[model samples]
Target chain A: MSATTNHPMVRFEGVTKRYGALTVLDDLNLEVGRGEKVAIIGPSGSGKTTVLRMLMTLERIDGGVIWVDGEPMTHMQKNGQMVPAEPKHLRRVRSKIGMVFQHFNLFPHMTALANCTEAPMTVLGLPRREAEERAAELLNMVGLGDKKGHYPAQLSGGQQQRVAIARALAMRPKIMLFDEVTSALDPELCGEVLQVIRKLGSEHDLTMLMVTHQMGFAKEFADRVCFFYQGKICEQGEPKELFTAPKNERTQQFLRAVLEAV
Target chain B: MGMFSLSAMLVAALIAIAIMSLFGDNALFMSGLLQGAWLTVQITLLGSLLAVIMATTAALFRLYGAPPLRWLAVTYVEFFRGTSALVQLFWLFFVLPLFGISMDPFSVGVLGLGLNIGAYGAEVVRGAVQGVHRGQWEATTALNMTRWQALKRIILPQAFVAMIPPWGNLFIELLKSTALVSLITMSDLTFRAKTINDTTMQTIPIFTLALLTYLVMSLTITIGMRWLERASLRGMVRGRGR
Candidate 1:
């Protein structure tokens, strides 16, 4: 639908990943337009998170390339041949991207404000005063301004995850990757993180690629949804259309299982 | 109680008092022993400093360097740990001259004590580093931090706290091991005791003072380590944060 959204913000061209004999992702291809929220849904071990991990460079592609803002990321052109991107160049390209992991991955030793400020001050080279001011703003945006001085162990899982979202945002990334950000939270705490994410998606005009199991949130929040199975996208389409009337039998089965589990 | 049991208890208690008085007395022999023990304390302090620097280097090389460097780290750790420190100290003092490398007595003593403890300290440093949660690596990498930056700013600070307990244990061991350096004619505490015994013809008194000084040094280090541990670990538990 929509003819693949010309000049996509994030594009994967025949990406593949393998863990020795396992083949975690097999010749996968996808595209997300600028400022679009796309959710990936699948059973455990279905390569759903692998897609996000690859974009974040936590996992490298076994074959093919990824383009962010229309520039190649997985490989660099060297001697007129595509080679694996060098670490230095890869870091520069990756700085434009941000990721929030399932476990919240907050720096345990730092307070929430310090966590938000660290990347800005260290990686972005912002002055301490400026970074602290921006971190305060981010904390307020995530509705955790009061918890800024608290370490991760002092915060609830949901609160820590929201801070992690704020930390990712502090980098001012063009593309944000969420790898099951809510799956680690308790049912009662999940709403707060999801709410912050939904607000960011609407207010910031951010490009987002998320892996989540909250079918209702995915249906309401994402512009498009992709259903993955056995290391490949089984089906992908507009959220409203895909959830209500899936084109693939696998997607229908997955939706039924997820809904029943919920 | 019977006289035999009562007397036996009295004898044990007197021995303890005698040991205590050896450290506290103002006798000529006590002062002589203390001067010798001072040498041991100084040697141990210098040796521990060398251990800290060398162990940190060995651990970093093993973690970040090329295969040859890593192999060298592993070899260094195993070599010193595998053999007795006495042999290494003796070999350094005696054999290296064949290859035209001769260090002074004090340097040899410090080097020997340092390298012996460095082997064990390297393992402690390595474990503490790798023990950090893998999530830290991902978070730092996501921020696009250079490897060294991540280690210095994010990883090593936490690792340093984790390392203190093992380092304390190493300090105590290093203190005890410094006595070995006296064999190289370093005039360390043990060597000083021998020198005094030769001059004053008082073996038991000099040795008793040497033992008490060592005990004091070890106890001081133990208390210091406990204090360091508490200070470093302070904010880890909630409700205690200042």
Candidate 2:
């Protein structure tokens, strides 16, 4: 595997994403080392969430390439020429990454266990018994073992978010992305969801990218923090330094506004 | 309330039978009409099956297929929805024979009704599928599901529940439209009614019986579909309890 430990788990090189005349992401260059925990924080519309979205392949990049595990993800090198990755290539690359959304987007028709097991059985070609076993373990890890038979609609917002985490973990992804995962939950329920993520951060050797508004959780859990402004990473440092002694004027103002609101 | 309605309907039906008995040979009328009704039932059951197949295929094409396939689906839905069902039926029954592609009257009736309603039903299916939340699509993609697998497992099942009421409506419309097939000599209920009226000149009683038969069939379909909707919704209701 070419000494996988030496390679960055994810690298974004001069990535750009635009919508019409508005540039959502502008020549972004970022890298996360293996097993690193990175948190993205910024004002809304500053492209904090876009960073995770582009990595998940949910949004297309207008320019530049993203590399995962030292392999080009957004483009494939074909015959010495870089071309947009084919669907097959995209699927293969994306399988290494898992994402949990703000809405907890669990399949309503499926029970929590089924939702957790679906990707393992369908995409990875794991047998049903093995997939179920893996899903159960992940569910238990997320503290949702008792809710496995419950459908998304039956679970509370916190429970559903936990199931979503387990579902993503069941895929055995090398990298995990969280896009405002606790944003939709009530303030009282947000802690339960954050706890699961905190546990993952401490226990797993997985690269994690999170876009979050929970300043306290980000400070406590993230190894490094990036503050984006106007589609660029305006400031980044250790979470303690970034949160407490932010140097950039924009990051200072953004943090002040957020802290005042809370 | 249910018992009252049932008894009221029974009394009204008995009184209507008493009046009809005074006019014509009820036995002969029923025998001829029953045969026609049987044929109508056959057409409806088969045509509805065909319509569901066509509608789902066209809807999937319109939503996810390549540009050319989407164009074809849109063309079909627009053309059929724009025109009258009668013209489409006549075109199938009378026009296609000239091309040496002849179909029996029964096949024409089923195809004519099925295709016409299928076009309308396609819109219902498309709307339901589109109404599914965007988050569901994102979740499937995040799970690394292929487009086909996503539709088959995640998107379509949720959409299918939304489609039931509308499909029920379309099926009833298809059932009623089957009466039009009588024009091409398929001898459905309407056709048999006309045959009875032609000889006996009992227009009021014959047409009335035909109308009542249609009402009964429509009622059955409505009730059956409502049961299906409730069954499908049971899991959702249970889930909401949390």
Candidate 3:
């Protein structure tokens, strides 16, 4: 919580991730300051999602290390040398981050209220009454207060996604990663989920990293937009500058393709 | 509508008349058969409880235990599934006594039937658990839940619904398999029926009565399991309306 301005909230230092010979992220280095809203945009296979996933600790790093809050995330110092982190170390670091997925992976067996409260009660050791109170507040914030008792199957894709966001926020994570959260929703429904995220972006001091296909939202909401291509950030800048005037040819081509599709 | 189905009422009346007529000639014999049938029920109930426990343990070992424990589970499942149930019963009843492990006939019957059916039930458990969507696991991990907590709270409850129907089949199979316990001198339904057959020399009537008794027990299991399945899935939206 006492993050100094000099130290970025999240830093990827020469981070490399690979699946056999296919490198998903190649010696990538990036940094996000506290409360910065960064959007990642790219064509499929560009490794935009991989960057968010690695930061969430959902994927293993092939080489190099990631730093969160100035501490190494993918490794721990052993005998003055960096070594791959143990599961205990990973869990301790991972508690600081929360992620929302494209599919809105809400537990279908649980009600929306239960889904939001589960992590707080079980993972954070909060008393049930306190967890329920916090979960109710989060559900209300996400505009699903009335639907708290409903199961995921009873909710629309947008509602489910919104509940997923609430569920993540209930943990009070320092960093929130959104991986194309609205991609699976219908065009009309995307607005509601995006609006909730927008409200959070403006109202909270939480650092946000998003991988999204919604270029318009990215332009409006992102402090900085990073354009990824072939597992590297080809270009990045303030949203207005990056979208309107691109210095990289790949970025220009990708934006044209995406805009034409829309 | 009446309290009972018309067909069920008709069946019940016919059974009462038949029993009354049959009772006049075979009163003592009918009473003896009823005692045997009660013993059969007792064995079935105890065996099923044991089978469920063994199957869950074996399935968990197969799914999440260390490599050596997994191998042990696989070996146990394959051995019991591959061998004949009758042979298994005979081995437990006849062979174990030779090794200074003398179990009573009733204990042998329960152990053999339970272990045999549990092996098949173990496969059912494994399939249901694995059938749970991969997204559920990812969701649990994202919530920072440990593997044990996830399995207990999310995965297993979902798997329970999928497991019920197949487990019903295994339960009935176990019930039918209990008849084999008669060979080891257990005074269950089949044993009593055989003893009566020896005395009365009325093969058709005695065996027919035994067959009907087994049918009634099997039907009860089917109906009871259906109720259990519905109760377990009561809150979930997918199967609720149906």
Computed on C-alpha atoms, the DockQ of candidate 2 is 0.51
When only the first chain is scored, the TM-scores of the models are 0.96, 0.98, 0.98
Total backbone clashes of model 3? 0
TM-score of each: 0.91, 0.95, 0.93
**lDDT of candidate 3 at residue B60, scale 0 to 100:** 98
Tens-place lDDT digits, model 3, residues A117-226: 99899989999999999999999999999998998888888999999999999989999999999988889999999999999999999999999999999999999999
Model 3: CAPRI class = acceptable
lDDT of 2 by residue, B172-213 (tens): 999999999999889999999998899988777788877777
Whole-structure CA lDDT of model 3: 0.88
Interface RMSD of each: 4.6, 3.4, 4.3
Q: Ten residues in a row with the worst lDDT in model 3 chain B?
A: B1-10
Worst 10 residues of 1 chain B by lDDT: B233-242
What is candidate 1's CA lDDT for residue A142? 95
Model 1 segments beyond 4 Å from truth?
Answer: A1-6, B1-26, B194-208, B237-242
Query: For candidate 2, what is the TM-score?
Result: 0.95
lDDT of each: 0.85, 0.89, 0.88
Position B197, candidate 3: lDDT: 88
* Per-candidate interface DockQ score: 0.34, 0.51, 0.40
Candidate 3 scores an iRMS of 4.3
